[model samples]
Every structure is written in structure tokens, then in C-alpha cells.
Target: MRIIISPAKKMRVDTDTLAWHDLPCMIDRAEVLYDKLASMSYDELKRLWKCNDAIAALNVERLHNSDLRIRLTPAILSYEGIQYQYMAPGVFTDEQLIYVQEHLRILSGLYGVVRPFDGVTPYRLEMQAKLPIEGAKDLYGFWGSAIADQLYQETDCIINLASKEYSVCVSRHQKPGTRFITCVFGEEKDGKVVEKGTLCKMARGEMVRYLAEANAKSPEAMKDFACLNYVFSPAHSDESTYVFLQKKSQDSEE
Candidate 1:
């Protein structure tokens, strides 16, 4: 089984510290996107990135100066989001790292799908970015079935931990006989499921860590995940969706 997750916008380049691995499988395709962004004027890029001056300037410099093939960090270590911060791949053991390398994939706007150990240079492009390619209206259109095809090649089953923006690419193009499962993390509140953004991120990260540590290799194995006070809610889950619910503080008190 493979677990898919979204790439984080908050990133850094740290080639000096980490050992570089092979470039992403679709690096040639990524080069096209990179060139398109590199060719845009500062104001146009700022608009495309939907960021302020500081971020725009830093990314522009990175695009102009960085060599994608020369220096890179592991894709798993590249992101610095709330989820990644909590998952903390940096501290994983060798066996855990191997398990993650084999089973975890990050869905990227720039790189399509990346393995945890894939070498990547930092740049900004979201899966939902509106930048139009020649024949495609948006990044999703350009990516099309390419990412899904790659995932299908890797594993027969996919445990989706990514947000919709990134997961859509895979969910839309599954070949017949493929198993796709989505994991939902939320809390019970007022007799409803409440998915707070930050807690969800933390739970997703923790869940990934749990799976890696346990070397979970099947859908049934993942059901055993009970990280950060979450418990698998069988009544709330189905074949396609697995829901893990945290008890509300008031409920915990009671």
C-alpha cells in the first residue's frame, strides 16, 4: 500500500546538509513548468504565486540561480508545514525511513508525484495554481492522468492522506481494479464531526509516522492507527473512507 499526501508551500533549500538522491521521476516535465515560471516577469510571477514582494523576490532568485540537478534535499525533508513539523521525518530511524521511502508519496504541483527520498529543489507552485500551459488551462489539466498512472505503477492500493487539491489528480484517474481509500481525521462535537484545520494536519502527520513506525502494509493495518487521541470510528467509516475521531474535551472530562 502507498500513502499519498500534499506538498507544503512552506519550503526551504538545504542541499548542504542532507544527502542528495535521484531526481524526481518526472524531472523533465518539471523542467517545463520551472522554465515557464522562470520566464515570467516579476509582477506576473507575483500574481501567479499569489504572494507578496518578499516571497516573490526570493522565489525568483531561486529559479534564476538554482540548478535542479546539482543540489537538492529529500522531498520529505523539504516541506516545513504544520503536518511536516509534527511528522518530523528528520528523526526517523533507518528502517522507518526505508518503509516511508517505499510507501509514502507526496503529490506536488511542480514534480507531479514524488517519493519521500526523491531529491528536490525548492520553488513555489501549487497544484491549484492557475498558470496555464500551452494546451492545458491549469496545472491539473497539464498533469492530467500522468500522476495517477505513476501511482498505479507503484502500488495497487492507495491510502489518501492528501487534501483535495492534490488528491483530485489521483482520484480522477484510477485504473479498474485499483483500491483507493481516504482517511479522515476529525473530532466529535455537538453530535457532529468537526475537522479543525490545524488538528487535522497534526493528526495526518502523526498518522503517517505511526504507519511508518509500524510498517503498516495493508488497509486493515492502517485501521490500527490511534495517534493523538484519535480512535477508528467504525460506524463513521466505510470501505472507501476511514474516519478517525478524537473525543471532545468536554466528553473527555465526562
Candidate 2:
């Protein structure tokens, strides 16, 4: 099974941690995107990124100077978001690292889909960003079925840990017969399942680590995940969705 996750908006360059094994599969396409972004003015890019001036300025500098092919960090190590922090791939054992290298795929707006150890430079673009390319209306349209098609080629079963923005790129164009399962981390609120953004990110990261350690080979194996006070809810889960609800703490129970 291939596991899919989203790219974090926050990133850093860490060429010293672990060497990148390969360039992203869609490097040529990424170059096309890079050139487009590189050509845009700082103000234009700032609007596209939808960020504060400081962030926009930083990325504008990165776009101008950072070479995508040179001095790259592994995709897993580059992202500095909470999810990556919890995944903590930097401390993984050789076996666990190997497992993730084989199964983990990071979905990116600029790179389409990248392997865990794929070489990448820090850049700012979100899957939902409205940067029109060629004849496509948005990044999603630009990616088309490319992400799903590539994932289908790797495995018939895909375990989606990505947020909806990135996951939609694959879900909308999955090949027939492919089994796509989404893992939801949430709490039971007012007798309904409610997912909060930060908690879900933490859970997703923890789940990646759990799967790597377990060397999970099947979707059924995922049901065994227990972390961050979450337990699988059979009542809320179906074939395509696995819902894990947070259990109240002892203090709260008292």
C-alpha cells in the first residue's frame, strides 16, 4: 500500500540531515512551474501565496536564488510543520526509514507527488492556490489526473493521510478498481464527528510514524493505530473512511 500525505506550507533547507535519494518524479513539470513563479513579480506572488509581507518577501527571495536541483533536502526532512515534527523522520531507524521511503508519498502543488526521500527545495505554493498554468484554471486543473495516475501505477490501494485540498487531486481522478482509504482523526462533538485542523495534523503525523514502525502492508493494519487518545470508531467508519475519535482524558472524566 502507498500512503499519501500533504506538503506543509512551512519548510526549511536541511542538506546535512540525510541525503536525498532522487529528484522528484515530475521534476520536468516542476521546472515548468518554477519558471512561471520565477517570472512573477513580488506583489503578484504575494497575492498568489496569500501571505503576509515578510513571508512573501522570503519566498520571493527563495524563488530567485534557490536551485531546485542543487543542495536539496529530502522531502520528508524539508517540511517543518507540526505534522513533520511529529513524524520525526530524522530520528527514524534504518528499517523504519526504509519502510517510509517505500510507502510514503508527499503531494505538492509545485511537484505533483514526491517520494519520501525525493530531493526538494523550500518553496511556497499550496494545492488550493489559484495560479493558472497553460490552459488550466488552477493548480488542481494543472495537475489533472497525473497524481492519481501515478499513485495507481504504484499500488491499487492508497492510504490517504493528506488534507482535503491535496487529497482531492487524487480522489477526483482515481483509476477504476483502485481502493482509496482516508483516515480521519477527530472527536465526537454534540453526537457528531468533528475534526479540528491542528489536532488532525498531529494525528496524521503520528499515524505516519505508527504505520512506518508497524510496516503496515494492508489497509486493515491501519485500524490498529492508537495514538493521541484516539480509538477507531467502527460505527463512524465505513469502507472508504476510518474515523478515530479522541477519548476524553482522566481529568476530564473526573
Candidate 3:
């Protein structure tokens, strides 16, 4: 089994972390996109990133100076989003880290798909970015089946923890034999499963940690995940979707 999660926009370049690995498998492909991004003017970049003055300037600078092959941080240590914060991969034991390396995959606009230990640099591309490259209409078109092909090379069962944007790239191109299961984290509100943004992110992160610690080998193992008061609801789940819900009050306090 393998798990796929979304890459975060909030990133940091930390040299303090000793764990590092070679560049992502699609580094060459990333360089091609980098070149396209680099050719755009600052104003164009601002438009591409859809950011404020500060963020746009920072990313423009990053695009100007960043090298895919040079300065790098482990993908696990780089992302600082709410999901990554909850996962707290830095606190994981060596065995858990190994499990993550073998089982987790990060969906990225820049790198396509990243392993936990893959070396990465700071960038500001989202999967939904509108940058039309070569003959392709957008990032999704440029990626096509490459991401799914890579995941299929790794494992047949994919536990998708990524958001819809990144997840579509995989779901659309899944191999015939692939088993894709999506875990839904939410609260049962008025008898309906309601997914709030922050709670869902927290649950997704905690679920990753749970999987790593338990060395989960199948989707059925995920039903045992009880982090942050989330409990599996079989009645709300189907064959391809697993629903884990917390109480409304329990989510509000967090």
C-alpha cells in the first residue's frame, strides 16, 4: 500500500535536518518547468502565483535564484502547512520514518510526485496553477499520466490523503489494477458528514502519523486510526471511501 498527500505552499529551507536524499525522479521535467517560470517577468510571476506584493516578490526572487539540483531540503522537513504541522514527521522514530519513506508519496506541481526523503527547494507552484506549458493547456495536462505511472511503479493500493486538485491527477490516470481509497475526515452534523477545512487537515496529518507508527499495510488498518477523537463510521463509508468523523464540539475546541 502507498499513501499520496498534497505538497504544501508554506515551505522552509532547513539545513539543520541531517536526513537528505537525491533529487526527485522527475527533476529533469521540473527543470523544464523551472525554465518556463524563470522566463516570465516579475509582473507575470505575480500573476502566476496570484499573491500579494510580499509573497510575489519572495517567489520572484526564489524563481530567479532557486536551482533544482543545488540547495535542497528533505520534502518531509520542508512543508510547514497545517497538515504537516499535525503530522510532525520530525518527531517520528527511525522505524516510523522508514515506513513513511517506503509508503508515502507527496503530489507536487513542481516535482510531480515526491518521496519523503526527496530533496526539494522552495517554490510556489500549485497543482491548479494556470501556467500553460508547451502544447499542454495547464500543469495537469503537462503531468498527464506520469504521476499515476510513477505511483503504479511503487504500489497497487493507493490511500489518497491529498486534496481534490492533486488527487484528480492520480485518480484520472489510475492503472487498471490500482485500488484507490479516499479517507474522509469530518463531523456528522445533522446526520450528514460535514468536512471543515482545518479539522480535515489536522485529521489527514494525524492519520499519516498513525499509519507510520502502526506500520499500516492495508486500507482496513486505517479503520483503527483514532487520532484527535476521530472514529471510523462504516455506515457513512463505501468500498472506495472511508469516513472518519469527530463530534461537532470536539472539532470546535481544536
Candidate 4:
């Protein structure tokens, strides 16, 4: 099974902790995107990035000076979002790290898809950003079915730990007979599963850690995941989605 997750917006360069095993598979495509972004003026790029002057300037500088091939951090270590922070790959055992390297795939706006150990540089493009490239209207159109196609080449089953923005790129273009299971971490409120953004990110990250440590190999294996107070709710889950509800604490229940 392949675990698909989203890339973090916040990133850093950490070349000392772990050596990247290889460059991203889509480096050529990333270079194409890099060239496109490089060609845009500061004002255009700032608008495209939808950030404040400070963030835009930082990213513009990153684009200008960064090389995709050099001084790269492992894709797993580069991201600094809550999800990655909670996953905490830096503390993982060697075997756990190997499990993740084999199973995890990160979806990116600039790079299409990357493995855990794939070398990557920091960049600011998001999948939903409106950058029309080579006649494609947006990143989704630009990526088309390529991402899903590559995932299929690896396995027939996919465990989606990514948010909708990145997961949609895979879900929308799934091939025939693929078992795409989405794990939903939320709470039952007013007869509905309500997903809190920050909590969900934490759960998603923890879930990846759980899977890696367990060396999970099947969809049924995922139902056993019980990290960060999330318990699988079979009543709410269906064939395509596995729902996990956060159990109320003793203090909260009082």
C-alpha cells in the first residue's frame, strides 16, 4: 500500500540530519515550473503566491538562488507544518524510517509527487494556485493523471493521509479497480463528523507514524490505528472512507 500525504507550506534546509537518497522523480517537471516562476516579475509572483510582502520576498529570493539538485533536504524533513512536526521523522528508528521510505508519497504543487527520501528545495507554490502552464489552466490540469498513474504503478491500494487539496489530484484520476481509502480524523458533533483543522493535521501526522512503526501492509491493518485519541468508527466509515472519531477525555465528559 502507498500512503499519500500533502506537502507543508513551511519548509527549511536540513542537510546534516539525513542524506537524501535521490532527487525527486519529477525534477524535470519541477525545473519547468521553476523556470516559469523565475520568469515572472516580483509583483506577478507575489500575486500568484498570495502572500504578504515579507513571504513573497522570501520565496522570490528562494526561487532566485535555490537549485533543486543541490543542498537538498529529505522531503520528509523539509516540511515544517503541524503534520510534519507531529510525525517527527527525525526521531524515528532506522527500520521505521525504511518503512516510510518504502510506503510514503508526498504530493507537491511544484514537483508533482515525491518519495520520503527524495531531495527537494523549499518553494512556495500550492496545488490550488492559478498558474497556467504550457496551455494547462492550473496545476491540477497541468498534472492531469500523471500523479495517480505513478501511484498505480506502485500499488493497487492507497491510504490517503493528505488533505483535500492534494488528495483530489489523486482521487479525481484514479484508475480502474484501485482501492483508494481516505482516513478521516474528526469528532462526531450534531450527528456529523466535524474535522478541526489543527487537530486533523496532528492526527494525520501521527497516523503516518503509526503506519510506519507498524509496517502496515493492508487496508484492514489501518483500522487498528488508535493514535492521538482517535478511534476508528466503523458505523461512520464506508468502503471509500475510514472515519476515526476523537474520544472525549474524562475531564471533558464530566
**TM-score, cand. 3:** 0.96
For model 2, the stretches where C-alpha displacement exceeds 4 angstroms are: none
List model 4 lDDT by residue over 160-234, tens digit each.
Answer: 999999999999988899899999999999999999999999999999988888888887888898888999999
Task: Name the lDDT value of residue 239 in candidate 4.
Answer: 91
- lDDT (Cα atoms) of all candidates against the true structure: 0.89, 0.93, 0.91, 0.94
Off by over 4 Å in 1: 250-254
Best by lDDT: 4
The residue-by-residue lDDT of candidate 3 on 1-254, one tens digit each, is 99999989999998677557878999999999999999999898888888999999888888888789877899999999999999999899999999999999999999999999999999999999999997998999999999999999988899999999999998998888679999999887788888988888899999999999898889899998888888999999987899998844645768
Better of 3 and 4 by TM-score: 4
Q: How many clashing pairs in candidate 3?
A: 0
Question: Model 1, clash count?
Answer: 0
Instruction: State the lDDT of candidate 2 residue by residue for 1-254, as single tens digits.
Output: 99999999899988887899999999999999999999999889999999999999899999999988998999999998989989999899999999999999999999999998999999999999999999998998889999999999999999999999999999999888889999999999888999999999999999999999998889898888889999999999999999999999999999
Model 3's alpha-carbon lDDT is 0.91
Model 1: per-residue lDDT, tens digit, 54-169? 99999999989987787788898899998898788989998999998899999999999898888998889999999999799999999999999999998889999899999999
- The worst-scoring run of ten residues by lDDT in candidate 2 lies at 170-179
Question: Global lDDT for candidate 4?
Answer: 0.94
- Model 3: residue 108 alpha-carbon error in angstroms: 0.3
Scanning candidate 1 in windows of ten residues, the lowest lDDT window is 13-22
